[model samples]
Target: MARGKEYGYLLDGLNSERAEMIKRALRAIPEIKSISIRPSQGTIQLIATKDPETQVKIACEVAGCVFRLKLGRGQLA
Candidate 1:
């Protein structure tokens, strides 16, 4: 892995298909190795192993208004 940073996004009110679309969009980034999603406190937590900024950009592009990312845990590796 490149080993700079990992990205985490909190997605709310999204169905499985939508989540998969997000995942696919994320995978389009060549640096991203893997992605994991789990339900947390009424939101879906998306953890992706890649550059943090790149992940956030991808999330914003793909999700648009359907989800918002938590700023706290945004940087992880």
Candidate 2:
């Protein structure tokens, strides 16, 4: 998919079920190449094209979560 930027976030009240739902929602977004969740670490990592913040926010909303901390941005390996 020629993935572009990598994004990471700490979403409040994260759990395995919520993370699973969030991942499902994010998959529907074409810009997102992939999604990773570190439940033990409370991290959500995304490899996406263009700007995914807004869509990420929406996906989180659908999962009943709000971003608590932005883990920052980076390039996908």
Using all chains and alpha carbons, the TM-scores for the candidates as numbered come to 0.55, 0.82
Against the reference, the lDDT scores of all candidates come to 0.54, 0.79
| TM-score quality measure for candidate 1 | 0.55
Top-TM-score structure, candidate number: 2
Model 2, 1-77: lDDT tens digits are 56587788778778899899988888888888978987777788888887677877887788887777677545222
In terms of lDDT, model 2 sits at 0.79
- Residues 5-73, candidate 1: write the lDDT tens digits: 445555665566666666677667666666665433324333444445556456645765244655455
At residue 72, what lDDT does model 1 achieve? Answer: 58
Worst 10 residues of 1 by lDDT: 39-48
